[model samples]
Target chain A: MAQASGKSAGKSFFGKFGVHIAVLIFVVIWTIPTLGILVSSLRDKDQIIASGWWNSFSSSTQTEAGRLPGPEAQVEKDGRFVIEGNIFGDGPARTISAFGVRSATPTQFQAGQAADLGDGVTLQLNPDGTFVLSSPVAIEGRGQRVYYASSAPPRFTTENYETVLFSEGIGRSFINSLTVTVPATIIPIMIAAFAAYALAWMRFPGRALIIATIIGLLVVPLQMTLIPLLQLYNGVALFFGVPSKTYLGIWLAHTGFGLPFAIYLLRSYMAGLPKELMESARIDGASDFEIFLKIVLPLSFPVLASFAIFQFLWVWNDLLVAIVFLGSGSDQLVLTGKLNALLGSRGGDWEILTTSAFVTIIVPLIVFFSLQRYFVRGLLAGSVKGG
Target chain B: MADLTLRQIKKAYGAINILHGIDLDIQSGEFVVFVGPSGCGKSTLLRTIAGLEEITSGELKIAGELVNDVPPSKRGIAMVFQSYALYPHMTVYDNMAFGMKIARENKAEIDRRVKQAADILQLTKYLDRLPKAMSGGQRQRVAIGRAIVRNPRVFLFDEPLSNLDAALRVATRIEIAKLKESMPNTTMIYVTHDQVEAMTLADRIVVLKDGRVEQVGTPMELYHHPGNLFVAQFIGSPAMNIVPATVEKTGASTTISITGGRKAEVPVATPADAAGAAISFGVRPEDLRIATGDSVLFEGRIDYIEQLGEVQLVYLDIGRPDTPLVVKLPGNSELKRDQLLKVDADPATLHIFNAKGRSFARDHAPALAA
Candidate 1:
């Protein structure tokens, strides 16, 4: 028995270690892209192109070209002709670590040292961008072309966010997304909650058939309804003399698409509630509506919260619904649509794309984190009794 | 307060019948408890009276007003559920006040009633706590308090104490009894599988089996004179023991011959035709005692003994191998297994059931009459 237990204990120790390793790998896999996008979006656009986002914290080295002062500006000092200038011309300074007369050996000459440029000419560049070019003969040409290796300090800025939000139209699309998502999330929940309560508690003929139909509808793919729903909306719009692609149209579309699952989820939860509660409420003289509003709604909070999170995330992150039901103009473009547009137009502009992606996910992240307790509770609502 | 009259209340789901034509008249202010085994439809009957379940065909009158088609709230009834059913998110105060608030009662009246109910249930300190934060007993009290604030004419409790632990069940049962006493004018109907609760807390107990009432009487009346075999076995702990016998003689005192050729006379009236009829001799385990007199009813080898500290159960093999005659003896009584022992009961306490499991009417034994 002791030996068996010892072996089992050893196996469990390794099992636990294996689980930790798997969790760590999962965490890394999930966090790396988000971390990369955040780091890339904050980086200088040039640095983002120069190297990966992983290297954004470290200084980047680049070989740059600058011109020395022309002979016309030469000054004779100590009986020698001299040309002087700074390598960085009135911009943010970069340290000139090394300079070379020839491009092939840019780093051969260290800073603060004079180098022979053949024919009795010498050039010295300081780390602070100050350069001195002196010649035994007066300099005759426009400034000699110089190549030097300079190291720029790491740059972090909100410029990418500003560009994405203001110029890239993500900020506008954000409001548009909220406009579509909030009403879409809320309308379905309202309709589904009432339907769920009725189906669960109220008595009516063909109730079972209605519940079965909803469950059947749950399996019907959303893609199958797109064209028919669009045509229906257009016909309605023509009849009502309103625009077809209005927020109201998309909100209704989403509500229609979301209702089946929402009702299915909520009805199951509502049905699972102790029958005595509804009976007690009824005995207390509450009307069906009153009981639904007072008892069923309050007790169904966990399932409601769970469904809200699901619907909110689905609506907020939806691209297909937005593109189909909403016009792609600046006025109606939602965040997902805007992100898709950015992906196409700024295909190589990682900075803008990353920034826009981060902006689009921020609200969902905030929502998920803030309501995670309810989300977990909602997910586990009917899986366990009284949980 | 109102009297509830249920006339031929029959509920059926297609062909499966539940509550087979239940007819019960609940007098105003009477505390009646429905006691039955599982699936006996006690809860269903209570729900029917609460107006939660529609009766398929019946006339229900509350205070002499036909309320068969009335909605539950309009029926002037409040129910405490077995699972408490307190709203999980609501504070005890709000939970108790919910009905009044829904009725749009005056705010001060709601407050007064809620506070009064809370005080009655000793829940004043926990009024602000949510149901989930309170213990099971406390939640049940909140449920009761919710019912109280409505001030309904009839109160219904559907196995309200069943959810609690043993000790808490007793405590809550007593609280319910007291609550019923305090609200004497309000008719209350309680349902429970626990006979002790029915015996202790009810003015009268209605024993149901298979969707029909087997007997309706006071606790002692049901205990001393069960109408049928089912109620006899169902009401008492460890159940009453039954021994098959042949009726040897029929009179004011019927004599039956047992399996082991022991003939005993039981004080029950039987007709002349009952002679030689197959019958069941009933005796409660608690009523049987070790016989010290010459008139030993039967002798049997002790099979086993269960020592419960206060009382010991002695199982005896009286010729029937499958059915053991269980005798309840005093705790200090010492008996050995496989030893033959004689047991007897007073003829007045003995019961004789006819072939159809109906108990014959009992007559006062000569000794008791004298």
Candidate 2:
């Protein structure tokens, strides 16, 4: 036994060391992309457009080398019009790579040099926005493209969020998502918790058949019932003079869809609670509802919180259910539906998509991390220790 | 408090019979215990009285109210469970106060009752602590206090101290005895498989076997004049020794012949037709003693010696008996293994049972009736 224990100790030490190595690898893999999105959101638009986010560690490029008009206002001296200008804007010039006159060939000339154009027009382009032009003709069409290497300013702004919230109609979707999520999460929990207590503890007829039917509902596809559910809601709404696609309709839809899993999870958890405890409560003169509210609810807070998180996140991030149950308007579009619209309309704007996507995920992330402890605690409660 | 009466209470679950018909009546303030082996339906009987389980076909009356169809909450009874089921989320004070709070009693009355219960259980200092924070013994007291706060006319305890450690079991058993004494008007029905608890705590014990009452009496009464062999064996440790015998003679005083042709007269009542019939003779281990050189009852070879710090029990291979005959000697006795020892006993301690395991004596035999 001692020899076997010695071998096991050696194996365990190496096993733990291997686990540390695996965790480090996992952390690196998970963190890099989130960091990329965060960093890409901070840099200025020009810098982001000019260089890849992976290259964000180094300085960005801005072309410099300005031109001046030729001497055309004075008396015609050597039959030339002249102008003078510098390359840089009001900002400081940091590096000069190449300059150009044509738009397609923007990086054609060097800074602080004279380039001969073959017809008495020797243009001297300085690093700053000061240059001399011999022709002195009007500059038209597109102006000279001054290309240089200038460091982009470290820019971080909430302008994208402001624009999305106020102008792009996502603010309404945010409120609409909350409208769907809170009631959807709460309604199912209240109903499911009662169902779970009855299924777990109460002696009644057809309990096994009810529980089995609920488990069967858990595996049924939401798509199969979507049309019928929508028709049911519409028929009821028409009778009540309510809108066909109101928040109540969608909340009810999500609640119905989320109920099977919620009831199954909570019933399993409540059933695992020691039967002795409930019998003790019964002997203490508590009714079924009294025991449920007083004993089962307090003991079931962890599982309740876990299921709340699950249903809340699912409803918050849901697109298919929202589309089926609601109209195509800003007033009822949830964050996920709004984001899908943004994908098609604002396809070229990475900043818009990333900012809106991040905003949509932010609520779920908060809900998950805040209630993660309850998730672990409730899962542990239903499996081993009590059962 | 008033007496509890159970008339032919039987329990069966869907074609599987758990408890056969049972009947008993307990006087007011009596600490009656139901003692039995495992799966013997003793706990079932206690639950039926508590209204946690319905009696299948019998009437159970608490304080003269037939509560067969009444709910547990409306039955006006409280129970302390085997697991000491205190609410895990509530403090000791809140746990004791929960039923009263639900009843909507005035705050002052609830507080007065809770404080009184806590004081009785000596749990005032730990009122603010949750049950999980308390030790096993402390939690059990809180469970009892919860029942005490209900202030029912009858208390049902379902193996309340079985979850305790040995030392705690003894201490809590004594506390329960003291609790019973304190509440002289509250009739308590306790159920336990531990005979020591029944022996030390009950005013009257109901020993049950196979869902029927085996015997019911005071501890000493049952010890001396058990009605059957089952009680004869169950009532004491190292159970009463039995050997086959024949009724050699019968009269107002019955005489029996041992297997080896030795005759003895027992002060018992038997029918005249019992002579020449087979019977079994029983005697307690402590009742038998070593025989002197001239004394005679039976003779045997010493087979084993077990010295239990306070007593030495000698096992003798009296050949005619189906098992080894054991005799318990006082602590200072000088008996050794393999010693051929002759054993004798006071004839009054001799217990003779008929062939059907029925004891052949009145309810209180001469051992105590003297």
Candidate 3:
């Protein structure tokens, strides 16, 4: 009973309520904007601008101006001359809440209330976009213009995604992104794993210096090296008689920029592995390379996976590096670059922008969720002991 | 089967010396244990023999072949680490078969050896489980099984039983002892700080201090004929008690006076120049008893009593409050606090050491004297 009481005491107010509240706050902070983009992407083109994504599930109130049908279509309904027609003739129905004859007071009169036109003429606009304009004398050939506040029912469609993907070049850029990100992620991880194992386990000259150098490289801003590296690449390309901006160049560029942090992360984790495991393997007749491949690599899976996720996400969302290394051609443009081009060209098109934004983040979401198990385990691996 | 030899093996990490010129000869089929206090370089010595560590200066030979520069695997040695470093990601079967797999042995032969080792360790049921799934003793057996699968000529253990709880430690100790019995031709070198393990499992024990071996002998030899005060105090449980004394008579049999003016004759011989010199008198707790007649060595008051099931430990304050001499008596012995007690020990069991804490050479052989 004392043990139970102690356990309960450990799980007091802060442990139960405060922790969940903190997690809820973080969930709200991260997912709210992503959810907004997703909801906006699926909305109809006009409704996207008509209201916020939060109001997409309900009707939205918007002021619109419409003219009644001409006198030719109007019919006499009473002893006095009466012209009757729906303001929204053949369009979708909208509920008009208020109406006015002038643009300055667009909602001057409530729907179903009569408004005098100053010379014995009256106009009544109903909630269903229908209006009755009557006069003591015969009505004119042209119908009256009325402004009204109307609410349209919620609209949702997949046409925005269709248009953006088919015509906006996002699909091709997605494939280009895959080509860049997959190779960029794999190359750095492969090289870093080998370098990490060598630095962690193998005894050699200047190994500590190499480790310190890698840690130093981690702090060097990529902006400082991007130009110099590009120039170096161009020089090599010029000597080799090849195009300067190629997919291979971007892959190598990303690999070069990502290697320091990758090696740093992987080496620290690999070094934390039990030293006796390596010594035991050595005495078991396995060489350094064999031990690295069989023992170290298999045990380092958590770290490797986490690095892969990091590199994948960074490369996928990268615009500066992709723009600097790759060409602007349709076939070579990456997703982030293509998204930037779309922002400039279709600045007013909310549907296109939201759809593109959602598409760009979807792949990273899938990657993170798929590998997040290993990511969390990797973070906690150092504190836990194995048998 | 192989005989192992170490000659002046010295290990240093940039002047922080860990081992200082360790020289040992381990015969084939012999179980040798290295026991010492922490920081005595016992584990480092084992690693050096396993070739996991390189000696700064000296030679290591296995089966008459100098393997100083050879890789661990090429030296025909297998080591069981203290942590039982079984690959966490592999199953028990794979953990045992990893070495043979790396050596590119035939599939049939690898399967046969792995299965045989598994059966010997009674791990046939746990073959498919991961290391983390098994208990501590089970994991320890797997580690030993991994070493056995290699068919090594020289087997080394680096404090293998240190990680287990008390009950499991005893069980695994027996398992390791049985493993040695089954492989009688293989030369095994074990390292542990627990002298009980060294005393029970070792055919010969090497006691180390400050990176130097103090004495090498059988367990009983070290118990009865400790080469120095350190070896005497380190070997037995409850530790041998040592008190300051002055040598008043030096001859074939030396007579020393304790702090309370009580003089006792030790059968061991002292050097002729040791007269009027201070010395340390040592005796094991179990070797002492309540004196009945006039052969009493010292009289004191009972300070405390601990009643174990079979034996009780009686702490006697021999007028020295800081250093109470312990005596092991029967559990049913009638004893009380502050009771005047006269304790005595056999002359043969008494140990005499010089002022430098070195044991005096024994010229009075009990067997020849009889």
Candidate 4:
């Protein structure tokens, strides 16, 4: 018996270790891209393109050609015509790593070296980008073209966030998304909670049939119904003489799409609650509504919070329903729509793209972290009695 | 005053009948306990009285009003469930106050009643604690406190102590007994499969079997005179020993011949038609003792003995190995296994049941006559 227990202990140790390893793997895989987007979004716009985000901590190097001031600025000194200037010319300071006359061999000469030009014209570039070009007689008309590699110190800033939030229309879209998603998430939860409580505990003639129908509706693809749903919405809007493309329209659309699963999940959870509790409450002089509001609702928090997270994340990240129901105008565009537009318009601007994407996900991250304690608890609620 | 009348109450689910036809009358302020084995519909009967379960066909009257169609809350009843069923998320104070709040009582009155109940159940210290924070016995008290805050006329308990541990069950059982003493005017119907709880706590015990009431009497009456074989075996531990016997004579004092060729006379009167009839002779193990004089009930060999602290249960093989007779003897007795022994019981304590398993004791209904 001891040996058997010892063997099982060994097996359990391996099993636990394996589970931890798998969890670590998943965390790393999910975190790396998010971390990259965050780092890239905070970097200076120029440095964002200069190097990968992994190299954002250190300096970035790039080679460029700059022309000295045309020979008009030359002077005679000790029988030599000399042209002296800073290669960077009062721009951002950079360390000149190497300099060359031709682009093909941009870094052929090290910094602080003078290259022999073979016509008694020697050029020198210092590490701080100061350079001098000298000739034995009068200089020529055109200035010298110097190709040099310069390294800029690493730069991090919130300028990308500022630009995206202020100028790129994302801030407005963020408010719009909140307007759509908060109601969309909340309205369905309220409606479905009532429906689920009725379907679970109240004995009505069609309760089982309604529950079955909702479960069946869970399989009907939202994609298949989106067009018909929008058509129906438009028909209703025309009848009511209301605008078709509005935040209310998108909110209702998301709620409609989210209700079937909400009802199904919440009903199953509410039904699994001990029947004795309802009976006890009934004996305590509570009506059906009172029992639901006071007892079942409180006990159903884990499931309710979990469903809120699911619906909030879903509606917040949704682009299709937002597009079809609401207009592409600035007032109705949600975060996902705004992020899509930014992706197309700012395709080459990693700073803008990363910043917008990060903004879009920040709400969901805060929501998930705040309510995530209930997420796993909700899923595991009905698996055990009185858990 | 709250008196419950259940007449021909039948509860069935589609075709499966859980309760056949139950008739019971509980007086005002009576502590009535329904004791039965598992699947005997004791809990169902309690729920029906609480109006939680609709009676399929019957008239249920609570406080002299028909409540068959009334909702549970309006029935003037409150039930404590086996699981305590205290709202898990509510504090003990809030749990007790919930019903009154739903009824929209004044806040001061609700406070007064809740605090009073909390004081009664010794729950004043735990009023702020949630049900999950309290121990099992404390949770049961909170449940009772919740019921009391409702101030229901009829209090129903569906095996309230079954969820508790053994020591806690005993302590809580005493607490419930004291609660009953203090109330004095609230009708309480408790249901349990534990006969010990039924015996110690009930003012009147209602024994049920297969959805029918077997017998209803005081504890001593049921112990001394069970109406049928089921109650006879069910009411006592180490159940009464019954040996097949043939009636040799029938009269006010009847004589029965046992299977082992011994004749014992019982004090129960039987009809003349019972002569020479096959019957069951029963003797409680506690009633049997070692015979000293010439009158011996059975001569047997001691087969085994279980030594309890104060008493020993000796199994005797009186020429019937399959049906050994168990006799309770003093624990300090010098007795050896496989030794010859003769045991006897008083003639008045002997029981005779007819072939139909009906007790023939004439004095069984004396309480009814009074």
- Cα lDDT of model 4 by residue, A50-102, tens digit: 89999999999998899988878899899898888898887999998999998
Q: What local distance difference test score does each model get?
A: 0.88, 0.82, 0.90, 0.90
Q: The CA-based lDDT of model 4 is what?
A: 0.90
> Cα deviation of B326 in candidate 2 (Å)?
3.2
Candidate 1 on B79-186: residue-level lDDT in tens? Answer: 888888777778999889877877899999999999998888899999999888998888888998898888889999988988899999888888888888898999
DockQ of each: 0.73, 0.52, 0.73, 0.86
TM-score of each: 0.94, 0.89, 0.90, 0.96
Question: What global local distance difference test value does model 1 have?
Answer: 0.88
lDDT of 2 by residue, A1-387 (tens): 999988988889879899999999999898777677667666556667777777777877765344432233323345565554554546654555556566566666776677766554566666544665554444333343344444554456777778778898888889988988999999999999999999999889999999999999998999999888878887988899988888888878888898999999899899887776787777667778888999989998989998988898888888899899988887788899899999999987877776777778779888989999987776666676652
Clashing pairs in 3: none
Off by over 4 Å in 4: A1-7, A75-79, B364-370
Instruction: Tell me the interface RMSD of every candidate, in Å.
Output: 1.4, 1.5, 0.7, 0.8
Docking class of 1: medium
DockQ of 2: 0.52
What would the DockQ be for model 3? 0.73
- 1 against 2, candidate with superior DockQ: 1
Cα lDDT of model 2 by residue, B1-370, tens digit: 8799899999988897777888899999999989989888998888888777777898888778898998887777888988887889999999999888878899999999999999999999999999989999999999999999999888989999889999999999999999999899999989998888888989999999988898998877778888889888888888898888999888877889987767777878788899898999898999888877565677788888888979988888888555888788897898777778887888778889999999986535544854
- Model 3 lDDT tens row, A156-252: 8999888888889999999999999999999999999999999998989999999999999999899998889899889989999998999999999
For every model in order, the TM-score on chain A comes to 0.94, 0.83, 0.87, 0.93
Cα RMSDs of all predictions? 2.8, 4.1, 3.8, 2.3
